[model samples]
Target chain A: MDDVLRQGVEIRLTVNGRKHREVVEPRLLLADFLRQRLGLTGTHLGCEQGVCGSCTVVVDGETMRSCLLFAAQMDGSGVETIEGLADDPDRLHPVQQAFWDHHGLQCGFCTPGMVLTAKALLEENPEPSGAEIREALAGNICRCTGYVFIVDSVKAAAETMASNAPRGESP
Target chain B: MKPAAFAYCAPRTLEEAISLLDEHGYDAKLLAGGQSLVPLMNLRLARPTVLVDINRVDGLAFVESGDEVVRIGAMTRHHTVATSSEIRGASPLLSHAAGHIGYRAIRHRGTLGGSLAHADPASELPCVAVTQSATVRVTGSAGERTIRADELFLAEMTTTLAPDEIVTSVAIPRIRPDEGWGFREFVRKVGDFAVVMAAALLRVADGRVASARLGLGGAEGTPRRVTEAEQALVGSVLGAETIEKAARVAAEAVEPTSDIHGSADYRRRLVHAMTRRALQDALGRLEAGHG
Candidate 1:
């Protein structure tokens, strides 16, 4: 208790290939940190608890709920949000393109989390079956898509990422 | 909803964490994965004055194999437990129960100790631990001690752990060659808490049940090991009659309370059905010689 500060705490971390060192309130969630302070609003805030996957992001190469994490807890960690998925703004990431082509979203609130989750899945498993794909995204709730097209989108993205992969590399 | 403002400190070592806990006492809360605590804080259910973050504590996240048991660190994430080849081979029932905890995202951040400390009656890990006869290790200002899993849980969202103590790890016995394990839970949604769940560990030798351990969750106010059901299967050959009797005993042992998801009678029925299914599944695995 002696070491605690009731005011803002300074934290340094990497987000979307960029480094940020800022002072934030101890209660600030990583979701709000990204959306409000950094202006990366793609990580949607739904349910505000760990239940909804709308605020999902890649933290140290694993998908996690941003809403459950305090900004200060992410110090020195690498986080990849929805903004970091594609290099070029004109062209979408393969997963996003697959989602678009397959109509995987309707309200689109859960799309960012879904796309990032799919990327994590594909990175771990290059050629996942439909059941595996479904199991991986089971956390991401999509009220609109009914998950049929979301599954199709992830499968399509897997193929696209595999084909676009570097020579002799399976990932 | 937003959490109320609180002071935060990340301890770098277990000693420092324990000292902090001793200093702050009931005013402090440990932030492990934050999967459960942060949500409760957001809902204003638990608003501690200080948060002692244990994420930076070194040497607390590991899984080691001993000669007789598998030792899992407190900070080991659910995904690690679910994907660990060693844990899968030694305690497949624990791994299977970990998969039922939440979805992949939550699993990535949720820790084994956090779930056990939360001690929700409907949670999967506590029931699994009770069925496996695991031992929960804790450290405090007084010293380190181990408590049996069945003795750790007291009531809903409660444990025997003191406010100044932190759970350090859990040790699960390795499945013997003759042991067969099964875990089953029924959930309304993909990631919801189970309505009724059963975990069974059975050892059958020469067509007779050598030993049986049964744990039921979401059926009463506390996650419990059903000794009556275990006694029903211990001396009998796991025949249909024995399984039915154990299921009936399990159902009768629990005092379920009605909730929005199910009525008391409905959950009792589920307890009976799932007890039978879990027993049958374990026996099937035993016959297949799958450990």
Candidate 2:
């Protein structure tokens, strides 16, 4: 037990296709590791407790609450955040484009998480009904748009991606 | 909301993890999925000095089907449990119940062993374990032992596990061809904790109830089997009148406490309604010959 009380533990992992190595305190959350250490503030933190989906990020192809995970836990994992979605500022990802076209966001505090969640959903399911879109985004809370436009945005994204339009990540 | 400073060790084997727990005793908390414990730590409600992370531990995440039972590793995530074809075939009730826990993100990280060891009464896995009479297997420095799910939970957020013991896996009996099951819960939102949840299992023989098991959560400090209601269903035709009697008995038997989510009276009414609906669902399944 005495050996366990080290000041820092070294971790090596990939974030958005980039490899990183760092020594971090065990108490540092994955959310803080991304926002503070990597300067990737795209992932927002609302309720740090898992209730709010504002801190959502894709780890190894599944969406997880970054706030609930420790930085050390990402030692050998692959993480995908909102910052990794589109390679170009001029051309948004299909999901992001759909959100813009449909006016899916108002305050935009919850948009990053919402977009990533929609990306994961569309990658797995190319054709989703409005109810399915709602169910998939249930974890992501959008207090501004009342979720009607958000649902429409995800639905349109699914259609655009399914139609074989020139896409960025195939999602 | 940062957690308090704590030493961390990600053990690669079960033996190393148990030794760490044995050495640290109550000062250490096992970190499986960190769904519940991390939140408590963030709020400063639980401040453990050592975090024994067992995510890297070998051979703890699996779902193995046997001739008579299905063995699920402790570290098996809720999403795996809900989506596993083996689990869905062997115990569809467990699979269905697992799918309803929290949300997709929570399901991806939350584990079966963590949920049971946390011992939240409103949680789905605990109620399913108690209803199906699953056996939890735990290991410590001393040795290994098995505990019935009925005796595992002591109270809300409490269990019979020793400070040095770690849950390894659970064994649940496979559903028989003649058995039917139904699960129902009331929640305020899509992924909120259930206000009241009910599960019903019935075995019909010759158009009559041969055996019955009913379990309820959020009605007491621990999820428990309603023996009186179960007894009332036995030897009776599973008709509307008989099901209503059992539901009423179930509603009257439990002592529920009020919370911000619901009142005790409201939970009682939920128990009655959920029980009736669950039993009706079970009967319908049985009639459809899937039981």
Candidate 3:
């Protein structure tokens, strides 16, 4: 086997549409890799375990648990966390604005995951009912409020985003 | 915390995976989704010298169903079954059970094959597999062999899989459109494991039960079929009274033990109640021709 120091694997990852080629330790989790190496800390980590959805990020267009995967495993995948959502100066993603307006978060640790979840939900369904939004966010655990505001935020985001949506299917 | 020190081998092909497993024998572990094994390794419950990572291996994550059977890949994630339109139409019971497994993230990474291989008494898939007469496909240095569901599991966290044998897929009989199926369980939290779970699959023909299969989890070391209860339902019409009587017999077949979740007697009673409800739901679905 190669030397342990050479355990830093050469991996190519596309984050937020920009690709980065770097050598990283196999032990570096995708969550930590994004935060520490790639300087994208918008993805939060609440429970290191997969319980809290705080570490959610989209890999290859599918929402996944970043904490559950190693950096080496996602070498060739396209990843999009909250950092990749919007660069447009004129408009903010609806899920972002909904959280800001509806007071969906208190501690703010779960906001990143909440926003990603909302983004995923709205992308798949332009008009999600309240129950559907709640069910979509079941993986995200918020210890602050009883999830009333979170559900409301998702519902409002769905409505607001639907009004200004592009006619094409989700990419 | 990181898992204990172990050599990791990331094989890019199935042949390489088998070669590694064959060489390392019992000391090598297959890391597919790592949903269960990673946690167990982190807790030091399972310490192995080598980990043969198969996440990079291709073509093992899928499900294929024929007229009478559905073959699900070993590396197929739980969410795959839960959201599969084909599986929902073919075997709603499997989809329903997969939907109730943990949360979305957990479901995204956890594999049906992993759950069955782990063989936890409280898990949903094993119990459902036993009830539905699924078959497990295993590959090893000896090529491959299929083990019937009843012979696959022997004890808690145990299976008939040889140390060098890797489970490739599970084969389930395709349910007829009018066949009845149900799974019911109680959980303390959204993603928590079940306290006790029960599964029922009844084949009804001409307004009478043709055959029935029943199984329970968290009530024994391994998921067990309630032969006595099944006998009660086979020749009778699928009705409230008959369903209730079958449930009573199903409860009598269990020797549940008390845990922090519930007492033995309480669990037995819950099993009976859930069995009754599930049978009713199954029959209702069959009569309505719901897939």
Candidate 4:
């Protein structure tokens, strides 16, 4: 606890497969850390209360609300934000591609969280039914698409990922 | 929204975490999955000066079976509890109820211990724990002790746990082969907190209910068992008439508070409907010989 009261605490963690070490205040949320500190604003914060999943990101292979976590808490952990979904901008991740093909976004505010949640779901369940996809994406609310297109996108991504070779990337 | 500034410490062991709690006393709060507490903190509803993060605590996340009970470490995530085959076998009611909690991402980060310690009256885990009569294990600087699920909750979002104590694990009695259980909840949205929830477990012998346990949430300040309803089912044939009688008793027994979600009368009505449906589901499972 004494270390926390200091001006800053040193934290070492990996974001999108890249390692970084920095000194940050214990109260800095992971969402702000990514958006302000690291310049990855894709992780949008809709409701910092965790009701809206717009700030969702993968922490050690599980989806977590970045707004609900302190940057200090993620020390030594691997985090995957929406920015990490695709390697090359031209060629998007399978999930992102499916979202584009299916018109899964109108405002695009929730797309990043939606795509990451769908990616995690597909990794765990290669083939999920429409109901399962809706259930998985229930936390990530998309006010524009009405979730019909989002479900279609996730379904298509599941098929595309299953046909492709097992990627070396962690889900 | 952002939480107020707080000193944070991630202790790597249960003993170390307990000692930190002892030191901080009322000024400290335990950080588990950060699902409930974090949200409350971000909303400025709870402001603890110290956050003792127990996520890094060793040997706290596990689900193991004892001779006649299932021992689940306090830090066991809701995702694991929902999908674990072992837990499903030992306590299908718990597994079923866990699956209904929030959504996939919320479940992944939420923990059993945190849910119990938070003691949200509308939550599924607390209702299930009361129905199953589970025992929570808590540790402090003084020693360790177990509290029954029925006695653990004192009110909404409040538990009987001391400020210096941390819940370690929960032991739930295994549901026997002859016993059947059912859980039902009514929520406004897919992942919203339940408005009214009911769970029932029954053991039948000679076409009559030998033993029964019924619990309801969102109908009162704390999730509670309706012993009058349970008593009504014992030795009964569990027919529609008997089930209706028990449901009426459950509805009458609970004192629900009126809120924006629903009126007190509406909640009582929900309690009746939910109780009847839960009992029917339990009887169906028993008839199918799958309980």
Candidate 5:
């Protein structure tokens, strides 16, 4: 057996474009590493189980369920959360801005993950169709707004991002 | 739901993974995406003293398409398989089933090899593997071998995998151009485990069925091939009587066990209705020339 696991292990993860290294238990989930270890609690943990997507984050530009990955699994990996999307104080990621403008959230428990999922989706496809948007965010479950506003927000964001991008570039 | 304390080892090579599994035997468990395993661990339903994390094992994340077989690496993410153009061309049924597993988050992290090895009767991948005639490749210290998909799954949440072995890849053989595929499941939610699921792949040649394969999940302790149904589908045309007979045979072959999601009788009904619908869907695809 590894000695570090018996004691603890040093886990280094790049989150929101920044590098973070810490010692955590083997059972520490990636969600807790962002929330408890790094004080980035914006990423909510609704269902500790994998059903709800509230704990979703982008790992190496791919969306993953943070609750399902152990912190150690992300060693030397790049993690992007909801906080990483907005660099400027006044500006949000197109997906995030679209959510606010379109009233995409009510209780807001599912917003961060929804925005992250949308950002990841639009990053790959700038002009996603309605059905594509539905499929892209199918993992995210929202209680309020009946998911109409959220889907609309992803569509609006996709359009805005599409219009903003240069030709021949991926969304 | 915090899991109990345990040792975790992220072996960097497949050799090390096999060695660790051999050393610990049943005391250790291989941790993949942790989508299914973590839930069990959190509930203390499964508590192992050691966890062999093979996420970093090199060359275990790929989708390989040979001239006739499409081999997916054991650790390949479901998202990768779902979006794989190669898989779309080679075995679209697998790509479709992978997409239908849970949701995006789960798909992004979950693995096909791990899911098939887990052999959960309610999961879609096992049924898909069986329906499509996939071959599961197992690697251990002894040697590498392959198990027919229909023979891979043993029981609920169990498989024929030895404690010392690791599932390395799943090879899905090519589908004839004339074959069509369809899958149907009755789950409470979009991503919930199925109460009853049926998948079909059949080839219509010479105005008659040339080959037929099916996998029924949640209808048996293990996802199994419906030999009785296959016998009926053979040499039949895409007609009402053929479908009815095949559906009845498929339903009768079912050895369903009841649970909270449904009763045995309800599942039996689903077996017939779902089999009929899935067969119709595959037939429609054949007619459209989109196989």
Candidate 6:
């Protein structure tokens, strides 16, 4: 029992292209660790249970609910948060810029997660249909903007990314 | 809401995980995808003093097709099952049911073993396993063993697994070449738990139903294989009359409880309708050359 139990676990992981090492309590969620310990607050926490997708982060290339995962579980995994989306500080990622152009956010609580989800969707599917976009973002809940604008924003982002791709690389 | 403070141990091997479980007994809960268990912990519905994290366990996340079964590792994610070509080719019913689990993020992180071990009556995978007659393999300090799906689930959110046992994998019998399947559920929202769900498989030979399997979820304390309904379809030609009779039998086969989402009577009606629709759907697939 002594070997199996620990007061705190030390985790070493990469977040948004940066390596981090921290010792955290076993119950501290990954969402809180990113916001409090690392001071990356772009990841929002809504409905700390797994219901809301506001705390979604790309862990090992798959979007997962950060609120449900303990910080200790991310020992060696690579995580991507909304803060890492931009290729440059002066420009937003195509997904984020599309949201800005199309008015995809209102109260802004669900924007970061919605943007990251759309980014993953477009990265995998450069030309997603309206229904496909809706299905991809269904886990994320938005109380404002009525979701019509978000769908349009994802569509716009897909178009921008397809056009930006180099000739034969475009899908 | 936050989970209570607890000790966490990430075991890199199955043997080590079993040993940890042996030491902690009921005080520890194995963490798979953490989609279900963490939510319960956050809400304070579950308060284990130790969490044995098995995500790092090697050789526990795979999908393989063998002579008679499609073997899925317990740690296989729902998204992987939903998207796997092998699973779709071997057992289209299981593949289709996996797609109906929670939304994309949940599917990306939730594991089939976690869902089955949780044994939520309203969940899709347990009912699919019961209808498909799958087998779950478990390991404990006493070594490894297998339990049939029918005997695995004992009650609501409870299974026959001992406290020190850990489910290792699930083996689903490959769908026979002559079988057709259908799955249907009535949910208020796309990701909400099913009010009543049905999965039906029919084996046709000589224009008659050679065998049938029917299962209903969210209609009782545990997902049940509706033998009476299945028996009503065997040897029949699957005509409208036979389908209606089986639907009625399915509606009468279980005693459902009323919750805020629905009444027992309403669920019974859903069972009848879903059964009829599922039978029709199965027949359509058979006619469309699912064989």
Residue pairs in candidate 1 whose N, alpha carbon or C atoms collide under 3 angstroms: none
Candidate 1, position A98, lDDT: 97
What fraction of the reference structure's interface contacts does model 6 contain?
Answer: 0.76
True contacts kept of each: 0.79, 0.75, 0.16, 0.71, 0.60, 0.76
Stretches off by above 4 angstroms in model 6 are A1-6, A169-171
lDDT winner, 2 or 6: 2
lDDT-superior candidate, 1 or 5: 1
TM-score of chain B of each: 0.97, 0.98, 0.95, 0.98, 0.97, 0.98
TM-scores of all predicted structures: 0.96, 0.97, 0.92, 0.96, 0.94, 0.96
Q: Tell me the interface RMSD of model 2, in angstroms.
A: 1.5
Q: What are the per-residue Cα lDDT tens digits for candidate 1 across A35-54? A: 99999999999999887799
Considering only N, C-alpha and C atoms within 3 Å, which residue pairs clash in candidate 5?
Answer: A123-A171
Docking quality (DockQ) of candidate 3: 0.34
The runs of at least 3 residues in candidate 2 whose Cα sits more than 4 Å from the true structure, single-residue gaps closed, are A1-6, A165-171
TM-scores (chain A) of the candidates: 0.92, 0.91, 0.91, 0.91, 0.91, 0.93
Q: Tens digit of lDDT per residue, candidate 3, span A1-171? A: 435523567889899999999887765678889999999999997776677789999988878888777777787889998988878835668888888889899988898998998898788888888877887888898999689998888888888887777768766
Which lDDT tens digits does candidate 3 get at residues B1-291? 555556667888888899999998888888877777766765567767677888888888888978888889989989899999877777789899998888776787889888888898888889888988899998888889999988999998999988778888998888777677888887776667888888888888777899888888888788889999989999898899999999999888888878788899998998898788888878887877743
Per-model interface RMSD values are 1.7, 1.5, 2.9, 1.8, 2.1, 2.0
DockQ of 6: 0.65
What shift in Å separates residue B234 of candidate 6 from its native position after superposition?
A: 0.9
Q: Name the candidate, 3 or 5, with the larger lDDT value.
A: 5
**Candidate with maximal lDDT:** 2
CAPRI classification of candidate 6 = medium
What value does the interface RMSD of model 5 take?
2.1
What's the ranking of the predictions by TM-score, best on top? 2, 6, 1, 4, 5, 3
Q: List ranges where model 3 is wrong by over 4 Å.
A: A1-6, A88-90, A167-171
lDDT of 6 by residue, B136-228 (tens): 999999989999998999999999999888888999999977888999999877777889999999999899999999999998889988999
Which residue pairs show collisions in model 3?
A: none
